[model samples]
Target: MTKAITLRADHGSDDLRRLARASRDAAQTRRLLALAAIYDGASRTEAARIGGVGLQIVRDWVARFNAEGPAGLVDRKAPGKSPRLGPEQRVALVQAVEAGPKPESHGVVRWRLVDLVRWMQDRFGVSVSRQTLGRELRRMGLRKLSARPQDQAQDPEPLEAFKKTFPPSWRRSASSCPRKPLELWWQDEARVGQKNGITRRWARRGTRPRAPHDQRTTWAYIFGAICPAKGKAAGLVMPYANTEAMQAHLTEISAAVEPGAHAVLILDQAGWHMSTHLAVPENITFLPLPPRSPELNPVENIWQYMRENWLSNRVFENYDDIVAHCCDAWNKLLAEPTRITSIGFRTWAHGS
Candidate 1:
């Protein structure tokens, strides 16, 4: 073999000296230590020992340094495989998603992962696994979200405008007199059990058992209110949700408040609440919630509590049964007005 190449001392080279001193990296320090050992007349074995590497590794580093210098010791850029989809293919995929799901794929109505993967193979002639497709979709900032069908007419602007005006309307005295305490009330109709369902099963001394049948029932609305201070709540069940129904609920609520107190009825800007036909007593003013912000209404909490505590898993045989159960739950809410008020006041109290 030819004579083995070795790093001779460049004692006068300021660049090498600066690189040795200024470098703070562990790998660079190790390499410099090995070089220093070699310059000090140590054997390759001793240099490898000082460098905490095998002699072969030390020799490799020495060879790299001789060929490409210190810069060569840094990591090289890793070359990765190209993506399965080209620019045109990715654009096509986005267009298909925007166009919505297609039928004849099956009885399936929605674009599920497996369906999309199959579609990609059929439409683009590009076969990709579900996991890979999911990753690609996410990389393109796509996410699955649910929305109400387009036919549902959701008018939120008036409700929003009312919410903004409500607090100020309540804060200002209905009468110019400053002595009257600020009395606020919320009125709304809550559906009791429109989506209630039940499964009924009967088993005898058993041959093959028959399948259980499901039962469903609908109930009317509960129009109600809560005073923020006393945790006082009162409401009534009505056959229909209309201005007449709302007027009756308001009349009951107005009767309950202390005499001479100005009351503001906080409610959503529903057609009935804003109807010209429905008359309000001079002491009772209406304040509507901001558009699309149902969470801002404290009375909603009472309805939620009722649903969770008494209504969710229970089955009512008829509308009358549901009405009775709702009345009982309403009474329980009335008994704890402080709780109702605490919940109602949360929106304003939290600066929300």
Candidate 2:
């Protein structure tokens, strides 16, 4: 029964039609075109037909257009329900996750979404679905990832000290090496064999995908090294992991170095790596990492990448086939030098 709101006098049918054409939002364009019909002296019923809505919606659009112009017609995100977890609750959740579950109390080694949901209900009397909890966890910058391996016997004190002293040692090694330039190389070995494990693959939701899993024992060792800064690598597909193989790998790595550059090869101290019988290369110096710390070397990640992409889920006929596959995988990795740079690069080892 009340009078309809007046639209802004500055915009005519032509102006509104132009604005409608320029608008990216479909709903906003519809509202603009409906208002244009009104400016053209069309009945409210006609404008409602243009908007594909009832007269009430057209009247609401008219009111919005009269108040704030075209922008007011644009869609606004709906204000949903308030957060289920408060600031204090969020802090508590982070602490509980970091501290991990007490096996005696929680009866689980790891925290799962359902387990966390139960925990929230028991501790704070809050009810949340797994999907909602997942969304909240992601919003809090958390993700489910495989945990890195850490030896129980690892001495944290020396490891921390070693990390702190890395820069000084790096500088000393650079100064000691006889070359105009220096190359930092990470070295490690991985055993690729017929007993290869399967990797994850994309599939439809609620369906599981499978890959070939071999149980044969035949294996080949990949003695690999990468100079991340140069995006270059040197490797040898060896039959065994011993002093002889290590010597051969060191020689290969030395040869891969630039003509005038000395390489500081950072590697873990295996028995062969520390063997006095192994001849040291003139162009390369060894920087042995602390014991039980394979994670310190980026070459471990290179091995993981190789296994996931090329070497996994396959059955090799024999030792020869294993060797061939290892070589092929290494060659494929070398072909993509940028992949080496991306996978092997460490900010601390390389730079900012």
Candidate 3:
């Protein structure tokens, strides 16, 4: 009769239990528990059940643990197939995404999925599906996003100047750790209505489920700001996002902050935001973002998050319904302050 495998005494002692308790990796913990069980005279089948893996996997893990110590339980790189694109081809692709297609040379105004696919085929002899290409682009931290309006003739000197004076400046360290608390509140305006956008959700296989969108083509703008240190959010809902509404929002934000503490608002240079008629509060300052750069403002992240989590896939009867739904979302999001802090905190301006 064939016999079952058992782990070594040294590897599966109380030390193994200590390692398991201290392990952050779930896979490693399971492996340690399985080994400890086996060392305690449990059958291979029993150990496999405890580890939530097949018996063969438990044996493989035991062998690896014997060969190297707790480190052996860490996930090893899969010896999979080599990459489709060569080194030079990947560099070319990255450069193309950064610089965009050359208008004069490529005779293309902007790059579409089909355009990128064609370019890759012609330039690197590679064929990639749209979905696969999207995955690769995401892996490279690139997204195919629709850009906001940018004035072509706008000078970038003022935007750079505003950055130098970022107050409560807390710079992140080389290890991506945040420094001192920054009093900067990220600010942005978003319009939500029956026309709110949609995101992917689970639906019956081979069937599509879609909510009413842009039905009334109406919207209510919400001006929101977040202080990461406090994890507190303040918002003003208004009929419009023009100069008057912006001033009102600023007034509300100024009131929300502590007395005599200067608050810096990092915002894009919208006409209403930078308009001469807009009143600048004494206790507040504006840090204008660079032209054509919407990604610089952390508040942009809140808009997408709100849509996805609380506001998407809804049907509103009237404009009042739209306002109610939108405000409810904002209130719910703000109720959990940690979510706000995690999404909108970026401290890179104050550095030596």
Candidate 4:
């Protein structure tokens, strides 16, 4: 027979009963009341019966209460199975995620959970399930997100430099434009056509929902520009993506600029945009983003928002129908100015 550990003398049976009454945790309250029974001169067997546990468990509880007072009675999270991946393995996994898998070596463009599991087995001789690896990735603060499209020939250095220098450049050019208030506008062109894509839709688990997709090639260009700060937008639906169409679009943008304010238009270095033949308005100045860096333009996001919300999953009857749909979508977008601000605002360009 083991000797019982002496509980702390400061907390008596009355103190424990009072604490038990006040305690919110039901398990903690039960343990406290059982200990109160023991404090009031009840036998350990009687205390065990009060706690609904065996005598050994009662003894264990007494040991814990003696060590840590009422807090010891509280339920603790059970430490489950140990992680299969060690610290060094976790670091390696993070590195692998940051530096995406090579297509030639990994035989896949993207790293899937199964691929990672196989890689872990090959790299460290540890077997982990996809579900477990997913848990680990989530624990590491990694999530699956859609990748942004970038041109193959894009220069990362210039793109980074452009973002860094954009604020100062805007300030300097803003003074030269000689407008009381300068509006920053992001410009881009998207093709809305009969050849429409199917976007994601809500459906029951393990079931695929179908949407209308078109194969016809007829399309029209939407020359779109947005001032995220003011939640202002200008757009033109055009038959072609040429200097004439660009000129028309620029004029429309110029007309749309607020009274007594000049527009500093940021755009990609498209041929139609940079053409010497096209006459730029005095109220608008061109600031071309680095070549092949479409991500720098917020209008890209606007196009994506429009396509996802309104333009996608539809079949157009003809060129006129495409134009009408494009107009309707753009108008719907303009109706919600806050949507424009939310979609197009960039901290790098607009500043806090």
Report lDDT (Cα) of residue 137, candidate 4: 98
Candidate 3 at residue 158, lDDT? 57
Model 3 residue-pair collision total: 1
Off by over 4 Å in 4: 1-42, 174-179
Candidate 4 clashing pairs, residues 3+ apart or interchain: none
Question: What digit string (tens of lDDT, one per residue) describes model 1 on residues 1-352?
Answer: 4345676444323455467677877687668767666766778888889889887888887787777776655556688877888888788878777677757654466778898888888878988888888888889988876432321344766545555665565676355546666577776778876455332335565655543222664778899888876567669998789989988987898887778777767777789989999878766777666655566677777776677666655667788988888888888877776668766775542225
Best prediction by lDDT: 4
In candidate 2, how many Å is residue 235 off? 0.8
Candidate number with the higher lDDT (1 or 2): 2
Q: What is the C-alpha RMSD of each candidate to the true structure, in Å?
A: 8.6, 4.8, 12.3, 2.6
Q: Taking the tens digit of each residue's C-alpha lDDT, what string does model 2 give over 1-352?
A: 8787777898999999999899899999999999999999999999999999999999999888888888989989999989999998788888888788999999998999999899889999999998988888888888887677888899888777777778568657868754468889999999988888788878999998888888778888999999998899999999899999999999999999999888888999999999999998988888889998887899999998998898888989999999888999999999999999998888766545
**lDDT (C-alpha) at residue 120 in model 4:** 96
| 246: Cα error in model 2, Å | 0.7
Against the true structure, candidate 2 has what lDDT?
0.89
Residue 146 displacement in candidate 3 (angstroms):
7.5
Model 3 clash pairs are 195-214
Candidate 1 CA-lDDT value:
0.72
Sorted on lDDT, highest at the top, how do the candidates line up? Answer: 4, 2, 3, 1
Lowest lDDT block of 10, candidate 4: 171-180
Candidate 1 residue 240 C-alpha distance from true site, Å: 5.0
lDDT for residue 264 in candidate 3, whole number 0-100 = 68
Ranking by TM-score: 4, 2, 3, 1
Residue 322 local lDDT, model 2 = 90
